[model samples]
Target: MTVQTWTFVIVGLTFALYILIAIWAKAASTKDFYVAGGGVSPLANGMATAADWMSAASFISMAGLISFMGYDGAVYLMGWTGGYVLLALLLAPYLRKFGKFTVPDFIGDRYYSNIARTVAVICAIIVSFTYVAGQMRGVGVVFARFLEVPVETGVYIGMIMVLFYATLGGMKGITYTQVAQYCILIFAFMVPAFFISFQLTGNMLPQLGFGGKVADGTYLLDKLDGLHRELGFAAYTEGSKSMIDVFAITLALMVGTAGLPHVIVRFFTVKKVSDARKSAGWALLFIAILYTTAPAIATFARTNLIQTVSEQPYASVPEWFSNWEETGLIVFEDKNDDGVIQYVGNQEKNELTIDRDIMVLANPEIANLPGWIIALVAAGGLAAALSTAAGLLLVISASISHDLIKKQIKPDISEKGELLWARIGSVLAVVVAGYFGINPPGFVAAVVALAFGLAAASFFPAIILGIFDKRMNKEGAVAGMVVGILLMLFYMMKFKLGLFGGGTKEEWWFGISPEGFGSIAMLINFIISFGISRFYPAPPEDVQEMVESIRYPRGAGAATHH
Candidate 1:
């Protein structure tokens, strides 16, 4: 069968499976809608969390960034995964034992302040919206290519599919559906990885193959580094980022990972604090399967891409080259009016430019793999994009329905009424997110990176301090979040978006990029929070006890809701 036929059959089969799971697991109450009845097993919760964590950026764009960023990309690999350790150790158990449906719920109850809760809700919505834009855009890209539709049409279709399941199942349906999605995404990711690993290095395992010898008896990393020099690129095994920059970037990502509301809410879906811990471990393990293999995929794709495209005549270039070029993902100028393609490593000077986001999705085509494998990739990319989008949209809906309407606007609203508003909120969020997907303000990678930075600046300090510091007052939490978010926004607007009349790296504070400014902003938040709290009277007696009680590892029972 042709690639299109395979894509249709495989994608259709996977979508059918997700819809079936959602139907079977439809939510019947607010509890079911919010936390999947809070009875999910550790293993199941882990799988769902993995699916939730690995967005389109993780599945489609990461390997591509690593392919080009070389060792500098370790910031992403380490910081993202490292944040999970912080979550499992620092926040997950405490939040689970607190036993609420959402992150803002914990903030409201712990700090004993409606204002603090409102701040958290604002931060959650902003962060989720920024992140969901990438997932929606990713859905559009895959559909545009595989389903042969306009990007706007693809995003609308994705919104429809997500709206169907998310509004109906809430967390209940999304949890089970995500379990299925994790299976499809991981299998799809690993298959091509294994195929390419075996073909390139005679090792079936991508993790081991990345460091092992290839056809010429040279180690893959060594060969990759060597080829990078010959091609005017930074060495694959060495990075140019300074030690301070790397440290700052990595820490920001770790804290941001621990702080994202969508991922944090997964802990509430489980049975106990122990389950939260175990589920985090399981989530990381599942995530590691793909994380460890990404560098290998990057190396393989980078090497294959250079070997196939560089110095080849335009007319003699491969079919995959022309295909991507037609999509404008790949472009050439024939700078000298020569027939040859001058594809350089530092792409700015080269006649050919290739979009890094296409690396994973186009890998199979570049290697001339079978149609089935290519089709599987399309399905996998969609699953990754959709699963994460569903989770983010849930957070958005829950914020408006549970936090805003029920808590702030109408305290006496019925649970059923709140659920209806939640569904309406989901539809609205999906529509706004789909519009951004069709017309992104920036590249998917850059947009999502800003989301992480925002989360790190705004939420990590507030949530962590609220739980760990007994004396931290509502005044301090509110002040810290506002300051943190403002700093990040200022830096991003100044550097990335070219607002405030624009700026450059030379003008950057301490030479740290906007992406790495979160670490600085977070530290400022911590300092300001503590400084302000010291001037005020201590937290109320009960609030101090609430903070102290959370320190213990025992007694995993749920907290009493107000």
Candidate 2:
């Protein structure tokens, strides 16, 4: 069968499986909608969390980032995974012990103020919506390429799928469907990697293949290092960033991962504090599978891409090259009128811009793999993007309906009415996100970094202080969020938007890129929170007792009051 035909068959089967699972596990109540009735097994929750966490960024854009950034990409790998360690060790068990349905619930009760919860809801909406916009864009890209449809149409298709499961089954249905997505996405990711590894290094595992010798009997790392130097770029394995910048970016990602409300809420689905811990470990294990493979895929794809295009005439480049070129992802400037493509860095001060988002989707083609593999990869990318978009939309909906509308504005609202508002919130969230995806304000990867920074700055300190420090009050949480978010905005606009008469690296107030500025913002938030918290009288005595209650697993059953 042709590549298109096979892709339709495989992808169709996967979609059918998702619908069946959603139908089988449809949620029946608000509890079911919010926490999957808190009956999900640790293993199942781990799988669902893996799907929720990976997103389009992991499945589609990561390898591409590594392909060009080289060692700098390691920061993402280390930062994102290491954040999970923090979550498992310090946050997950305690949050689960607190036994609330959402992150805002914990903050609201722990601080003894509904206003604090309102701030959390606002922050969660911002973070989730920013992140989901990228996923929606990713869905559009995948559909346009593989399904042979316009990008907008692809996003609409994704929206319908998400609405079907997320609205009907709620968390219950979404969790089960996510498990299926995890399976399909992982298999699709690893199989092509294995084949490419064998073809390049005679190794079945891509990780070892990355470090192994290539066809010329030279280490791949050494070859890449040489190429980078020859092309006026930094060495492939060494970083050009200052130690402070590196530390800042890593810290931001760690705190940001711990702060993400969507990730935190997943622990609530597990039955016990211990189960939450186990689930975190399992989630990390699942994430590591993809994390480790991503760099290898980057190396393999970059090398193959250079070799394929370096000596070939631009006009005679393969059909695949032309197809991607049409998308404006891959460009060649035929400098010097040599006809042969030059893969070197710009020597004439003219740079060719290639979108990093294309690395994974274009990898199979670069390696001359069968067309079916390419199509399967496209489908897998859609699954990754859509699954994450759905999760983010749910968080956005819950923040507005559960936290804002019902909890704060109208506490007496009927449960049925609240659920209806939640669905409305979901639709609005999807529309806004779809619009942003179709017309992004900036680069996809850059927008993602901003979202992480915002989450790190505004939410991480509040959540951490709320759980660990009984003295933290509503004033502290609110002030911290306000200051942190404002600082992040100022820093981002300074460098990213050139709002302050254009930004220069040398003029950076602290030599931190906007990407790495979150750590400083988070630190400022923590310091301000602690300073003000010491002066303020402290949370109510009952709230202190709540903190104590959340510290142990024995009394967790009673932590849920409703």
Q: Write the per-residue lDDT of candidate 2 for residues 1-562, one digit (tens) a residue.
A: 7666877888888888888888998777778888899989989899889999888888998888888889888788878888889988988888887778888877777777888888888888888887888888888777776666777887788878787778878888888988888888898899899999999988999999999988889988888778777766667798778888888888888888888888888998987777888888888889899999999999998888767776577778887788777665567775678677666676574334577888898899888889778877987887788778878888988888888888889999988888888788888988898888887656566677778898999988988888778788889888999899889988888888888687889987677888888899999999999888888887888888877667655655433552
Q: How close is candidate 1 to the true structure, as a TM-score?
A: 0.97
- Give, for candidate 1, the lowest lDDT window spanning 10 residues: 553-562
The reply for model 1, stretches above 4 Å from the true place, is: 346-349, 557-562
True-structure lDDT of candidate 2: 0.83
| lDDT scores of the candidates, listed in order | 0.89, 0.83
Clash pairs detected, candidate 1: none
- Residue 424 CA error for candidate 1 (Å)? 0.9
**Model 2 TM-score relative to the real fold:** 0.96
Whole-model lDDT, candidate 1?
0.89
